[model samples]
Target chain A: MAQVVAVTMTVNGVKSTHHPEPRTLLVHYLREKLGLTGTHVGCDTSQCGSCTVHVDGMAIKSCTMFAVQAEGANVTTIEGMGEIGHLHALQTGFWEEHGLQCGFCTPGMIMSSADLLSHNPNPSESEIRHALEGNFCRCTGYHNIVKAVQNAAHSMAQSAMAQAADD
Target chain B: MYTSEFTYHKASSVSDALAQLASNPDAKLLAGGHSLIPTMKLRLASPSALIDVSSLPELRGIRTEGDTIIIGAMTTHRELEFSKVPLLSEVARLIGDPMVRNKGTIGGALAHADPSADYPAAILALNAKIKIQSSSGARVVTADEFFQGMFTTALAPGEMLVEIHVPASVKGAAYEKFAHPASRYAVAGVAVVVHSDGSLRAAVTGAGDHAMRLTKLESEGVSSACKGLVSASDLMGDHFASAEYRAHLVDVMASKALARAK
Candidate 1:
């Protein structure tokens, strides 16, 4: 059997370290080791984005990456987006617009959306669809999810403008 | 599903990686892990050791030198999708979803040599060259020469692809694919590169085990006029796709891509 090794990295703005089996997946590392279970795993194959996370400011399917591969990288899961009091624009849009049903894919969808907006603050509808193509939601039929992204874009733009005006 | 137990060695530099590879001949280089991890979980590949080359600084980023654009092997699909180079960025955006793009690397994809992959066609159309390094030294191979057949490449044992170089003279390049519903890989994809003189070159993926250039047709002086082009149906007779269907798609997609370029 292979031996486990210690891995160090930054997660959710916190420096962290852990020992994991060489075969341990990044999804398992986040959900089990780091106690951040918001990321879901719908399909073990990389086809499903349920295990999506941001590694070094880019969206990636954590299930397809080994935990040790994330060593020294900055990772952000759904848990890092917001908390009880403050909601990220994506969370607010989804909550208000009924973007989810089964909720199994919410965290991944939200995480992917955040990654998209972080790169392109204003994306067209087709671009939004293209961005979310990797993420699959079986319950909501994607109508509300698209609406949620559009709404979030507007909210984010307004907030950005407000901050710009203050400055 | 879970992966089998295996030793992991993270090499900080290219020399260290070469030493690890030389010591463990059965070791596989680990980059994005998008393709390798899934195969491991499925028990299709059970290497004794994994040489982690993801952190090799020399194997990341995109820059231009002289007449060629050099893209480090470890550059992720996300980086490519957001690249300032229009052709590279468009090709990157055509890959699977954002998550897949984030972790999948150009080197990993080329090494895997999945014929249905979009990048192969793009690289083939752009006439890119792949560079490989090992303990012995480094060697360069063209994209067409690198890919041998289905799931096969020209890489020798212990050799790792380090960079891909594309000539800057290429202009008016575009990629289009009919993605499979589940995997998002191209069922039949075509990438077309047109020179300023209207000379055209095309590469097709998802039609065979390895991406192939339509040299027979190109040599026949297939013009940008989009008239009398070969159909996907005529190009089939291979394992992955039928000749007639692929021929028809070739006509449709090639014309569409050409039109889009205009």
Candidate 2:
């Protein structure tokens, strides 16, 4: 039998509480308990970054951390980024730039890129590639992924400048 | 894919953690959870309980004290990578990806002492001191005396590593590695530190059972001309690279590190 632990977290702007096995990973908790299926698990090992998410504003591979460790923390999944009609800049950039051929790794790539863009609004192409070293995409060969991140950065900067002008 | 059942304890202080460890001999301290969690999931290490110390204020901070920089044990790799400490920060930037850096702690990496871990070479090269705390009090161990073997250290059963102290007298230092493609671990990594007094220390990792000082190269003054001084047996081989190849890469990496230091 496994020891169960009570965890309370603010996931996707919603407060959630649950009791799960202490061994339950944060990835499994988000997928099984919270029903946020956007976070994919390509490799259970920490090597693959398919399960990337934002923990207190920092990108982390969900499979590497236990759910109990995130108690009282704020978690952001891909679903929190935007709705289907109003997609995030990364989502649209990926769509317009053909960043994915298989789409399995898109959520993680986009989520990891989201954290990157927040930290570096105007990352160079090499910087985008370096920031995405952890999150891999078997499809697309990363050429288009690099283009998509650059596209997003350009648009995000334009919007920021637009907002600043309005302000 | 799943870890064995274990209880979780959130430790508020070092004494509280030590008390818990005394009560449960099989309990392990969890810092950053980057190293321990993965091992736990593989069932390679099944502690009866995990004492979470990632958030302990007592074990988190980076400060300069005179000629030495004192870094709290819980300081994450991301913090170190961005910090002003030259050689240490350079080593931190080469560890894993940003996500891994955000969660991997220097103390946890040092305590685990993976054969390919990056910190050991840097610590040994910089002549850093490790501060360990037990229920009795605190003690310091030199980097050479701290690392005993692969997956082993000088830490007593109940003692907690509290801080790392690095001297600031390095004129220049650099770490160079031939990284394993997938894991980014050093296949043959070398750290070279040139002290302000013109003396040097050299350390190698991922080329042996544990990170070790390359005394021959240090004595020879860490130059491109010292490649022939390294012995073949010091290099390790596996599915990744042959011992001969690793020895070759050691020379290559050491030369690169020396160039960067210069």
Candidate 3:
């Protein structure tokens, strides 16, 4: 019923090529084809941030984009982030700050927070709240989520300073 | 959510996109895919083919040519948020969210003309112009004439919106909106612009079937107890908001926008 199209994109620092239907969402391409399931789909609609991922270094809802549209993009999923032993700062923050009652929205929260930190390294508490507006955490309120982001920002700043001192 | 299958054509150039449109006739031009893709997923729109114009260099970036600020069709909302382009940047900051802003383009917002979309109010108030291109040639239309009724625009069958031109000297401008909490779409939004000669232009969105100018507010200024902030006849009323409530919002939002305009 659909014509298959060849799409090639860099995923999590790995080059992958796949033939998919023109209508296949990038989220599906990641989950079904690449077997990367960290990015959840709380809502297939664009309203939920669970499917958020970095495309060419910018956070976008993967479900809103077609795999074919990502023709030559460099996408960074949660899998591309730090591994189990060495988690990204946001991931570490979530663990330490009790950020999740249920872990469904954790990947999107981390991905979106990473984008915010990339632009505004030391965001104020309100800025962190505004940045996480797209991401919804129903099981737990945003109190812990905000704390988690602040915790990550604080640690990341400390690490940067330590690295500068080492240099 | 699986969208209906359609042939995808990644256009290499503006002309290439136009040729694809000319050949397919029913093809929809895809820029950013923020608005169009969601619609396709919902089965609200199912075009047989999509000509991807998101990557065309000819339809990207922002520039200033003399007294006018020219914005390419593919300029994403995130770029405009930091562009410092007067009212546009202020309005762009409030659209959808960070992720949606990253992939949503100004041209896509204008072309889709969802009635509740934010930019129509800002563009109309700023007296911006829309540049449209077809296989025939390119033509510019004033923002006032660009948007038609209810999810419609002046764009023709084979044409695509290419650029937007706004006066560089919009000294005083501001936008205020009562947004839907989850989606951040405007429930009642107002944009006000003060021209160099001190003339006023204001427009309203989300309260009506299509965005329209607040001629009374512009003529009398916000200091006045501007009677009839919006026409009762032209408003949209759903379970979320009543026509009476939206009228009240126009007054409240207009005052807020006017106060912020400097």
Q: Using lDDT as the measure, which candidate wins?
A: 3
Best by DockQ: 3
For candidate 3, the docking band is high
* Better by lDDT, candidate 2 or 1: 2
lDDT of 1 by residue, A35-151 (tens): 898998888798778999999888888888888888889999898999988988999999989999989999999999998898788888888888999999999989899899989
* lDDT (10s digit) by residue, model 2, range A124-164: 98888888899888878999999999988888888889999
Question: lDDT tens digits, residues B38-72, model 2?
Answer: 88888899998999999999899899899999999
Model 2 quality (TM-score): 0.98
Per-candidate DockQ versus the true complex?
0.84, 0.86, 0.88
lDDT of 3: 0.91
Q: Which is the better candidate, 1 or 2, if ranked by TM-score?
A: 2
Candidate 2, after superposition: displacement of residue A111 in Å? 1.5
Q: At residue B173, what lDDT does model 3 achieve?
A: 92
Q: Rate the local accuracy (lDDT) of all candidates.
A: 0.84, 0.90, 0.91
| Per-residue lDDT over A1-167 for candidate 3, one digit per residue giving the tens place of the 0 to 100 score | 67999999999999989999999999999999999999988798888799999999999999999999888999999999899899999999999999998899999999999999999999998999889889989887889898999999999999999999999
Interface RMSD of each: 1.0, 0.9, 0.8
Ranking by lDDT: 3, 2, 1
